[model samples]
Target: MPSASLSVKGRISMINFNTMNLRQENNIRRRFIMKKAARFLVVILSMMFLWGCELALIGIGASVGVGTYKFIEGKLERPYPIELQKAWDATNTALTNLQISVSGSLLEGAKGNIEGVRKDGVTVYISLKDEGQKVTTIGVRVGTFGDRIEADLVHKEIAAAAGL
Candidate 1:
């Protein structure tokens, strides 16, 4: 029988089946979109967390390529294979070697901050964090914004002083 000539009950059932199918389709589409969005979010968050993670070999006089450091968000950071105390001492020696007069410094427990100014009057900030197991992470920032070259130079000095 033609759908148009179906009994009232039959017509209602047919309409309900179509409506159900549409609802199921919409739900499936929503789920697909949600899955894609979730995957995209995961990728973006991973990238953000690994922003300054670059592994480079450091020879006797190698530059900052694939070095044990990173420059992210105006901070050139690195995880040195040394303890906090040694890293702090290295930082001081590095500054002195570079003639960047230390204006202020604070070393407490496993964390430290050193503020200095280059000869040209550019402000420099360095932070040290202990990662346990005799590992320390150092972050360096130059000036209000960020100077990659200057930061690298600072890191080189620190690394040399630390004997890394």
Candidate 2:
């Protein structure tokens, strides 16, 4: 009788030890998952904050129908009071007048991108954005590294062509 009691006590202790170990493992796994999730959230929040700061600093709001011209992100952007199709046609004519051959053209909905290359191998890119209500914006970039003067000249030609 004494031996049987000892054996039962030993089995109960073993079961208790196994249950404790399982609980500990579950706690550790839960903590690990929580830590990983926290880290991921921190990274996502940081990216969002950085993007917001960039938009603020660049004054994206100031460009809407302001009809102002400025250089941003290596490109010259100008807002105009014109329709999308008209602006796109004028831009193509302006490039042609400047002796730039249109190499590629992409138009989707109310936006367009036109790429041209000069005889001297200088490339120019023109982007048009129509924000509805007769508010259109034009962005110009010249060459790979961007030439501000050339871009301004192209913009002037485009404005003339558009009768703006």
Candidate 3:
């Protein structure tokens, strides 16, 4: 038997209403929706991966699980194998040894922020965070726009002071 058809707006729509059961029509609609949803999910995941790649290129995103030294967001950061207190002391000693006058300091629980002013009048900020037992993360930034060389020097000084 020929399937019934209707002409609407110069387009012919075929309807096998008499041949296809309601369950079959419903299954077809469900499959279409599922396919569309899967396509959308793939697009979203691809966009996320691209964004992560951009961040990595700009030195702002690194694999957190690796615990490696990384330059991120205009700062240098590294995970040190030392306690929080020890890290804090090392940072302070480093600043002093470099003749950088500390302008401000804040220590709250497992996190610390130390701000200092160099002899050249450039400001520097050092941040320390406790990552785990006997593990601490240190970050160094110099001036408002970030001086990479100065930041690197500060990090090296901290490591030397800590004997790490």
Using Cα atoms with residue i matched to residue i, what is each candidate's TM-score against the true structure? 0.61, 0.60, 0.60
True-structure lDDT of candidate 2: 0.85
Tens-place lDDT per residue, model 1, 42-104, is 999998887654432222222322265656799988778788999999999999999999999
**Alpha carbon lDDT of each predicted model:** 0.85, 0.85, 0.82
Query: Where does candidate 1 clash, by residue pair?
Result: 56-66, 56-67
Clashing pairs in 3: none
The residue-level lDDT of candidate 3 at 130 comes to 91
User: How far is 142's C-alpha from truth in model 2 (Å)?
Assistant: 0.1
- Candidate 2, 1-164: lDDT as tens digits: 35635577799999999999999999999999999999999999998878746344333543444346778777998877788999999999999899999999999998999999999999899999986777678999998878889999999999899987
Model 1, which residues run further than 4 Å from truth? 1-66
- Model 3 residue 156 distance off true place after TM-score fit, in angstroms: 0.6
The worst-scoring run of ten residues by lDDT in candidate 1 lies at 57-66
How much does candidate 1 score in TM-score?
0.61
Q: Candidate 3 — which residues are off by over 4 angstroms?
A: 1-67
